[model samples]
Target: MTSTHADAHILVSMTYASRANPNVSATDFNEILQQAQINNAANSITGMLTFNKDYFLQTIEGPRAQINRLLYILISDERHHDLQIIDTRELKHREWAKWSMNYASPTEENAAIYLKYSTTIGFNPYLLNAESAHGLMNELSAQKG
Candidate 1:
């Protein structure tokens, strides 16, 4: 049976640190995005990823089991650290249903969207709460495709 957002088991929103890994080059980042799109599509997962110089804030929604599985993988992945689940709740609709993994990196043209949630216009996830984190992801997702 198919599931609507309300019928879905979970909707998770999280923010995490990315400083645990070495600087990612464009090739490496693109590779990660490619893999995420493939994997997320297969698993019925949908999310948006927003990254700046220091942190990664993502919002993922899908089956509870699948989300849990992804979370496990993320925790074990050494590419990032300090995974923080900022919000978890049942929702009526998926905010990012259009893409398996829509992503955005702050740039000169789009820094404003990413910085709207930050107090100092810096892309620091640590200074944000669950609401702001979700907002940040939403803004980033709206930046481009």
Candidate 2:
């Protein structure tokens, strides 16, 4: 169920994880986000990425085919490892329509939200169930971009 502008398909939402690159600096992540923003905006993609010290959990939504392609690229990237998709579904509409790629990195100010929805205060998505993971993503999506 791929999509083009004219032959539009269902919105595909996916969540995936990878090991955080230990050496990558904040500047590097900002560069990555900058690139993501440009690419997502061009492709009409909307999603959020949550990064703690050890893992990354991201949920992306866009055309089915475009999502497929992006997944392929993500899997092939060497910056991280243990990459796996936790959820994928067809959506009638996008959940994060205003976001190109909203990055929600862990911080003291934002720790409470993660603590509330996550299994524990450590807030690791890798240990979360599909429902919890998606619930956390939904909460993140509602935040101001």
Instruction: Give the alpha-carbon lDDT of every model.
Output: 0.72, 0.78
The candidate scoring highest on TM-score is 2
* lDDT, model 1, position 95: 74
| Model 1 segments more than 4 A misplaced | 1-20
Per-candidate TM-scores read 0.82, 0.86
Model 2, residue 55: C-alpha shift (Å): 1.1
TM value for model 1: 0.82
Local accuracy of candidate 2 as per-residue lDDT tens digits, 1-145: 4346653567889988778778767776787788889999988788888877677898889987788888888887666678888888889988778789987876666667788766655767777766888777766656533
lDDT of each residue in 1-145, candidate 1, tens digit only? 3434553555544344444366666676677788889999998888887776566777778777677778889888777777777777665677778999999887887877765777874667777887777777766666675
- Model 2 weakest lDDT span, ten residues long: 1-10
